[model samples]
Target: MYQSDITQFLNQLKQQKPTLEAEQRRGRSLLWDKQPVDLDERAKQQASRVEQTPYVYYQNF
Candidate 1:
């Protein structure tokens, strides 16, 4: 049996821990591991909007 360059690379890769999945987890934790900020509960009160569309629609002949 003979190992090609790619095979050797893969064999070395097989020994590694904190692999791609672990690295992703660590990165996410580093960036996103924090208490979530609370959102404002107050509703945006606005004055009643005037109608912009035609109040009466007639079919075109």
Candidate 2:
């Protein structure tokens, strides 16, 4: 009985915790092992879209 209870708890946890269920790749799962986006490439892409000058870059912490 106790073992069954533990198994039920673990099953509940598996349903709740993201890192477990995220392995299936069904929906937009959280990026567990994701690479950092290239800031330079992103900036170049944005710069190509907009034709403006004197832009101020502010760092938000």
Candidate 3:
């Protein structure tokens, strides 16, 4: 949860806060710095999964 990081940030705020750009980069790094989703792969995953029953268990072997 970045508790320590938040504490450090608050402590720094008490003394000297960082610049707006620096804060923006830090916050963005925490949440928005992820790989983009691939539409094709997502579609493949959604379409590829199907449920099928191949065997009947009611009769004796």
> Could you estimate the TM-score for every candidate?
0.28, 0.32, 0.34
Better of 1 and 3 by TM-score: 3
In angstroms, the error of model 3 at 1 is 40
Lowest-sum lDDT 10-residue window in model 2: 52-61
Steric clashes per prediction: 0, 0, 0
Q: Give me the candidate number with maximum TM-score.
A: 3
- Identify the runs in model 1 with alpha carbons over 4 angstroms from their true place: 1-18, 35-61
Off by over 4 Å in 3: 1-15, 19-24, 50-61
Ranking by lDDT: 3, 2, 1
Model 1, residue 14: distance off in Å is 9.7
What tens-digit string does per-residue lDDT give for candidate 1 at 2-55?
Answer: 999999987777677438678888999999898764444222222344455564
lDDT of 3 by residue, 1-61 (tens): 4569889888778567547668889999999898889999999998998855566565455
Can you list the residue pairs that collide in candidate 1? none
Q: After superposing candidate 2 on the true structure, give the runs of residues whose Cα lies further than 4 Å from its correct spot.
A: 1-33, 50-61
Order by TM-score, highest first:
3, 2, 1
What is the per-residue lDDT of model 2 for residues 1-61, given as tens digits with 9 covering 90 to 100? 3568889998898879858665567344454646789999999898889554555464332
RMSD of 2: 9.3
Tell how far residue 31 is off in model 1, in angstroms: 0.4
